[model samples]
Target: MKSDIRVCASWREHHDRPVYTLTATCPACGGDAVNSAPAPYDPTDRYGEYRRALKRRARQ
Candidate 1:
């Protein structure tokens, strides 16, 4: 089966320390979901091109 994809709003703290947060809006009902990661989070999907794509989309 195919999994659903959710678009999210995300941010990172880049001052003294760097932390990442991602929050998604439900496409069906407009509800919100969130996730957070400490420094050195997964560099694959968490910090990789996919995350960059999300951030880029959010800016537009």
Candidate 2:
């Protein structure tokens, strides 16, 4: 059976620091099938990328 993998965000607090982990799972199964060793992307910079895109557009 082929299972479609879906990316999910897991948020929590560790040692007073916010931890964001990107996890992958298959609906056909149950919980996450893969837990990334390090986050694929930074949660804090979520809007930063968008802001940078806007700045680039303005400069064009």
Candidate 3:
């Protein structure tokens, strides 16, 4: 079995200050690391679909 992993935003604080964090995941493998760097070929991500859906709802 395979599970989809994705990089979602996280948050941390510097001495209680606001901050943002970046993380990665693999959708095909459970808890596996994902590479986000430019690939030799085209890079595809599911985030685009989410963005499009949001846009559609916003326009409604």
lDDT of 1: 0.43
Instruction: For each candidate, give its TM-score against the true structure.
Output: 0.26, 0.27, 0.28
* Top candidate when judged by lDDT against the true structure: 2
Candidate 3 residue 17 C-alpha distance from true site, Å:
30
| Candidate 1 residue lDDT tens string, 1-60 | 222433322222213332222335534334453433324545565458877899999999
RMSD of each: 14.4, 11.2, 11.7
lDDT of model number 2: 0.46
lDDT of 1 at 49: 82
Better lDDT candidate (2, 3) = 2
Better of 2 and 3 by TM-score: 3
RMSD of 1: 14.4
TM-score of 2: 0.27
- For model 3, what is the alpha-carbon lDDT of residue 45? 70
Model 2 weakest lDDT span, ten residues long:
6-15
At residue 43, give the lDDT of candidate 2: 67
Q: Candidate 2, residues 16-35: lDDT per residue as tens digits?
A: 33332343543433334444
> Which residue pairs in model 2 clash with each other?
none
Clashes of each: 0, 0, 4
Model 2: residues >4 Å from true position, as ranges?
1-43
State residue 48's C-alpha deviation in candidate 3, in Å: 0.5
